[model samples]
Target: MLDADLKEQLKAYLERVTRPIEITASVDDSAASNELRGLLADLTALSDKITVTERRDDDQRKPSFALTTPGQDISLRFAGIPLGHEFTSLVLALLQVGGHPSKLAADVIEQIRNLDGDFKFETYFSLSCHNCPDVVQALNLMAVLNPRIQHVAIDGALFQSEVDERQVGSVPMIFLNGQMFGAGRMSAEEILAKVDTGASAREAEKLKAKAAFDVLIVGGGPAGAAAAIYAARKGIRTGIAAERFGGQVLDTMGIENFISVKETEGPKMAAALEQHVRQYDVDLMNLQRAEKLVAAGDDGLVEVQLAGGASLKSKTVILSTGARWRQMGVPGENEYRNKGVAYCPHCDGPLFKGKRVAVIGGGNSGVEAAIDLAGIVTHVTLIEFDSKLRADAVLQRKLYSLPNVRVILSALSTEVTGDGQKVNGLTYKDRGTDEQHHVELEGIFVQIGLLPNTEWLKDSGVALSPRGEIIVDDRGQTSLPGVFAAGDVTTVPYKQIVIAMGEGSKAALSAFDHLIRHSAPAESAKAA
Candidate 1:
């Protein structure tokens, strides 16, 4: 069942319906049926305009939901419970069926509108997988927009038999017309590109740079998108370069604490973010990661070296290359990633709920993860490398406040032990006594630290923190003038979406201010 706050939020979002959306669920003997029934019932109760008609299908191995208008059949279906991270898809599906269009770029809409042939897209996802929702939303919205396209998002866990038949080994494994389309997360542009059967996957025209620009943003995460949007409002030549736009957000699950939006999955929000960025005049360079940055001297253009061997230039720059989760580098750590070892508790924690789990950190994040996992999982073993917990006193109190959590201080994670299919447990060492010990847990949430993605600027002379985060001042200015930085890659402390977005806006404004103060002379020199 949805929580009171989340339920209220969903109700509010669903209030936009001018007509009822019919949901007919075929419940079978699957293990997820009761929970799925409760979830659907709760959703139906939220709005008078939403209704659920349940039928017991003896042959049905899994539950199915087909949302339609009155007396109209929509082939769009969900093959299992849409709880956990998939909750976003369910909500988005309802909205789509109820006539609330999820925004996409005008150009993208036009392309989908012109699509020919009957298309079938099946995207396999886990409810706890954060990256699944975006692809689901994209495919679902495509189906909603184009009647010729039928999208079915099947929960990979519930339908293991079908999953095995399809060889779906990962989350967001998509099949276009029953052919293995893509695995993991995807962007709207990429999804649309794939949907265009007439075009090759590489047929998406490469985004080229303008001769020059006033501001160029590197990295298309939340920060880069925000910066691009803000910079474009100034009517300046603004461009953004990113190998992949969503960054960490693509892998994230459900985001509940994103300020106003009570509940949103990573992929859906990332698509919306990209869509909003596309609304502006910002030049977008997709699939282009910045390989290096060349700082411009006074009145010179700063250059951004991309991974694809292309370089772009601008008068002012905003570095928003985001950070990645710090790895422990133990044996099987990489091997068992997504198999049982996960970096994001928010994204993958629910999958391990009611199972035993371990949190590997003594810091605020680690302690927070321990507390959170303790509530979800049956037992939580908190491991720390220090003699004492390094988290703040308040967080330590909250962590200690939990009864299901046990603390092991001065411990170093040794190896992630697994059965080859999934994580079964891990080994740890007593840092003080050097005694090796093994613990049994189904999941491991790594919360050690975040390593900033500023390595590309290493030779560019951007002053970085000892840990490699870009150092920026209050105004979001980097060590070099005409260059600014924001988001997790910067030394701005907290690494939240709202914080990154706000920092990006600040960086863009500061870049504009810097241009106003420094541009006249550069223009005059060009004239002379």
Candidate 2:
């Protein structure tokens, strides 16, 4: 199943194995089972430390395989062809099961090992979902670390009956101990915080004891990483507190316009950004959400209160908290979220395979989503509020050429109609005829662009545009002195990644200049 170059790469990665590992597959006589068997044979051929076996006695999911050491109690399984976005998860499972050490922090490993109760985690994922691997890999690592923890990464496409029974209309839907746990992208730290309960309190205590920073950034997207690197390069006490590092960039699928670099995936770019920032002395804080930004106090330090009940003080603050996918406020949209309404077509499109769906918008993202969904879904209805699509000429051409797609312009999405458990259709109003219509579909992908993440700063004296974006000067300075903003959260014209990085660097420099002017001696300033 693997190509020549892929085989060479797998061989090189498998050479790190120091222990014998066995792959036990419980597969039926189906085409998917044959594919899985072929993949296993290819893996076995790549390394001497790996071996494959068949098992029919175990009451496990068919077309699935388990990775375990000879005498270890590890229980990690993949209930589908772990290719595409999940190929990394498969490789990591192989390596880690063969005695390759994990890169997780010492404390996190200990926390996983010390968990008292049993955790049977089943994660439903799609091959196209860029966010599913993180959750799968995390749970696999937990399973490898603790015998009490077991994880099975199931491909929702392959297990249609189970997905329908569970009402899973979204990718990366997770169930724990036979109950719905959560959904969407989740990191190891976030998962730990949810299960460990006391982890947040401990983290809050640690953050409270931290000293005031010279330059503190409040996001971890392109802008925040650039600001952190620039500030740390100045030999200042730099720190970054982000709700989740990578911001909206993590949700992006493809980036062909990042200059110099031809193309890259979102997760790959986010990892590179984080790695670049870590090369500096900047203190990186992930999963730290900022709740409020306090103006300069008597101590000449600005404070940012976190949702975790801890507050951080800084000499200068940079707000780069980026943006999130704008939601359609129509009725039933919220109620049907993940049930039939999804924001990312790449992640959730496979879940609606052979089913009718609608793409709500006529912009670049919306058109692209419709074009992509045309291949996988039975029919795609593209609804636009404007008279014409706002996408580029080439994209619009490609979208119109799709046989399975239909376009409706000057149509406003009125309401999302769904059964209590899943979506059945969508309601829309035709502006030209002043008439309403409904389209039967299994899913709705909303691509109405982004909303700035500045709602938390609304009452903090920070000036915001009518659209809620942070208003900044040419130097990236917000209305609040000693405070700055950058990226999509600011009034910047373009929300591109490169522009955000430049704005972040400029904001850092402006913060540094402000410090120099304010901290200088008054006598020297008067003489000058």
Error at 366, model 2, angstroms: 0.4
The 0-to-1 C-alpha lDDT of every candidate, in the order given, reads: 0.82, 0.94
lDDT of 1 by residue, 1-528 (tens): 889999999999999876689887888666677778888889888998988888895454468787888754456789888877778788888987898866776877778767888888898877767777878988888887778888898876677667546545457778888898887677666776555754433333243335888999999999999999999999999998886898878766568999989998777788799889989887887767778888895548998876545678889999999998899999999887766787766545656657899899999789988887777789999999889998999999898878999999989899999887778898999888899999998888899988888777888989998889999999999998799999999999889999999999999999999998887887899999
Query: What clash pairs does model 1 have?
Result: 130-253, 243-288
Tens digits of per-residue lDDT, candidate 2, 1-528, equal: 999999999999999999999999999888999999999999989998889999877788988999999889999999989999999999999999999999999999999999889999999999999999999999999999999999999999999888888989898999999999989899988899889989999999999999999999999999999999999999999999999998888888999999999999998999999999999999998999999999998899999999999999999999999999999899999999999899999999999999999999899999999999999999999999999999999999999888899999999899999879999999999999989999999999999999999889989999999999999999999998899988999999989999999999999999999888887886587889
Output the worst ten-in-a-row residue range by lDDT, candidate 2: 516-525
The candidate maximizing TM-score is 2
In TM-score terms, candidate 1 sits at 0.76
